[model samples]
Target: MVLYAPLLFLLVLVGVQFALWALAQLGVQYAANHALQTTRVSGGTAAAGRADAAAVLDQVAGQVVVDPRVSVTRNPDTATVAVAGRVPAVVPFLRLQVTTEVSAPTERFRALTLSLTSPSPAGEGDPR
Candidate 1:
């Protein structure tokens, strides 16, 4: 019974560690997505994206993620955000880092112009 019990305990610890890792990964991904969305919108900035990511991490995964690093970039055409952090160690010897990146085109507003003249009949417009 002793041998079997230790084996069972180890298995349970491993499972719990895996769950923690998964949770951390998911949290980082969510933060990255939110940051990307914030930065991709019109008039958004990279600083705003980083701030948004930090806020999200603090609100959602503060305990699970440790020392999170957020990076954001914005340009004329596209925006990107990345979040990375180490997950709280569940097993004595195993430590894992979770990272996520998201990117999309920046939002822009353009003026649409309407045609001033109506089209002629198909046969009449044709040269033939």
Candidate 2:
């Protein structure tokens, strides 16, 4: 039984660390997706999207993530959000990280116009 105690403790430590990492990853992914959606709005800006992502990461991830960073990119028609950070190491002197990105199309309104023109008044063969 004495020999098994250390192994059991190690297993529990690894399990708890993995669980925390998984939760942090999920939270970061969710934040990225949320930021992408926010940036997809007609008038949203990349800075705004980045702020939103950062806010969510801080709120949900807490200490699970270390050195977290948020990035946002925008094009004429699309927006993307990326979240990156290291998950606190389970083993001494080891570090593991996760990065996730989410993208969405921007929303906008467009105008439609229609015009009708009389067929060429004088077709070459038309009898006047």
Best by TM-score: 1
- How high a TM-score does candidate 2 get? 0.83
Which lDDT value does model 2 have at 75? Answer: 92
Worst 10-residue lDDT window for candidate 1 reads 87-96
- For candidate 2, give the lDDT of residue 117: 57
Give candidate 2's error at residue 16 in angstroms: 0.4
Per-residue lDDT of candidate 2, residues 36-57 (tens digit): 9888899999999988988888
As for candidate 2, its clashing pairs are none
Model 1 clash pairs are none
- The per-residue C-alpha lDDT of model 2 at residue 128 equals 75
